[model samples]
Target: MSTLAIDKRTLRQDTWWLEPMLVVLGLGAFAVYSTWAALQNGNYYAAPYLSPFYSPCLAINCEHVSVPLFGSWYNWSPAILILWIPGGFRLTCYYYRKAYYRSFFWSPPACAVRDAASGYSGETRFPFILQNIHRYFFWASLPILAFLWWDAIIAFNFGGSFGIGLGTLVLIANAALLSLYSFSCHSCRHLCGGGLNSFKTAPGRYKAWGIITKLNEKHMQIAWTSLVWVGLTDVYVRLLAHGVIQDLRFI
Candidate 1:
């Protein structure tokens, strides 16, 4: 027995895995819930309110007529094709990438932990490199947000007059949170002219960039809240569509 070297990566081991564990739990729950909701494919629309899960309902045969913004013809799960826009944007989101890369892939789950792999090459090759398309997805996601806002706006139109309901408020919250999440994105921040050479010339972009920079500070928090709100919005619409609950109108 010659000499042995101890891997002294961490000494104080008080709940070091807590953060990663929480991330796994939170993301896992969202994944499970979203999957179930998508597969159910029922109760996604009700009168003036359409579930975020099935907006811009492109299929003519969409169960609900108020939706079908594109005259649905696909005759499949609209959410399947439609949800991917926002889904891909979030999946490639810089903040979410960091959270999942560490927790889900366990590339050194915490500051002092050792990674499962021997070396860190970064996002240089193959699948990891695909993250570069996040900016493209960001652009693609903008139009969908317009659709979501349309849904939120129409939600207030109960029989052509001003109206409010539990669903209306939920849709409003969902749209608001999603807007925050999307606009607060690092990509959005950069698009707002963050890399500008001088603010003296581009006053408009500078103003917009300044607002985005402030919002970007809380991007991670808004991301989580928006994710949760989108799901809850769909849930509320589901229950209302299924007659599991009433709309609880207040206008």
Candidate 2:
């Protein structure tokens, strides 16, 4: 009698697919919501609170003039121009790459699991090679982060006077979380100490490297938190702008 051998993807498995499934759900939901919000072009700004998606609003139709790079003849969402900065930053992010590659591509969805594809070229080819520009995206994101902080600072100003509101806190938290995420980036760490021959020789850079390393340790957690928080921040601003909810003043 001839026996047939059955091939298996992984032998040691304890619900390994759960994590990837959850990643898909989270990323999918955020993508859908963010795309819809960006296309609205309205309800992204309310006094003292501007959605991060619409900040640095470069469109001719923007309620708040932010550079006004586009001509009056131009018509579309201002977000399309700026969202690419943050979007690209996250798309090429180290943690995000692993998350999407596994969940979306099923490229060894979990450790010990077989990749869906038969051949593994690894990010050496055309499109994946673009991920090497993540450092450039990191640099571009700094100004956006600065603008977010500026927005958060202005959120405390109610008609040129100091004030606080729920939206103010939200914006502040959004900026803070994003700052953590950005500073904790692998590129940021490399920038701080990439070429140092010895940490003892470069004390200041060594310190900065140490600090960024600490943040990098929590990079994955901060990445997820910042991702969720930023989306919620935009939603909050949208609700305020649309008059769906009134921002409660704390002081």
Candidate 3:
């Protein structure tokens, strides 16, 4: 519990800063890799498998995961256009906000620890207020998740024939993990049951909200798992695209 006492005090403990340091390293590494991957347009898709970065491939030049719906009028990386949805959603996520706030900003880094900044204004100002748009991102992510599910299903086929391969399994796991992450989101919880006046009125939605609420309890775990799996999915597809590794088949 925070006290109103004006005392220049700090937690007398070992490893207080460890959590923040790990957060910095983890987030920084992911940022660098995602930026590098997004710039590589042609390298994103492998035959019958699409990197999440380039799912619903909109460019005409998409050779592997070729949908080409918008027509290739502009010569630009497709990720720049599509990455914003999930990127924005995760950026504004309530869990992530607490994460970066402590890790990057050192704002009261740990319980009973003082914030590094002396004077602070809360999220009512400038860009901090932008987080209120998270729910909108949650809305946008629904369609994107549908698209990803479609892509994962599409991965099971090779040359118009039903088949199974290592990539198929990877894509399946990636989609499943990501779905769990989204379902477990706090916004999703609210959408399901937060506004309800009485659970006795809506049995179906109430049941769903109950399940989602359980997922919400493990939100942090799902969030990190999805993050790691996404990167792994991209790496597996990249290797296949480059012929660095071949997809192993079963059935």
Residue 112 CA displacement from its true place in model 2, Å: 0.6
lDDT of 3 at 82: 81
Clashing residue pairs for model 2: none
CA lDDT of 105 in candidate 2?
Answer: 93
What is each predicted model's overall lDDT from 0 to 1?
0.85, 0.91, 0.85
Better of 2 and 3 by lDDT: 2
RMSD of each: 2.4, 2.2, 2.7
How high a TM-score does candidate 3 get? 0.93
TM-score: model 2 vs. ground truth:
0.95
Candidate 1 weakest lDDT stretch, 10 residues? 64-73
**lDDT, residue 180, candidate 1:** 90
The candidate, 1 or 2, that scores higher on lDDT is 2
* Model 2 regions lying over 4 Å from their true place: 1-7
lDDT of 3 at 38: 87
Give candidate 1 misplaced runs (Cα > 4 Å). Answer: 1-6, 65-73
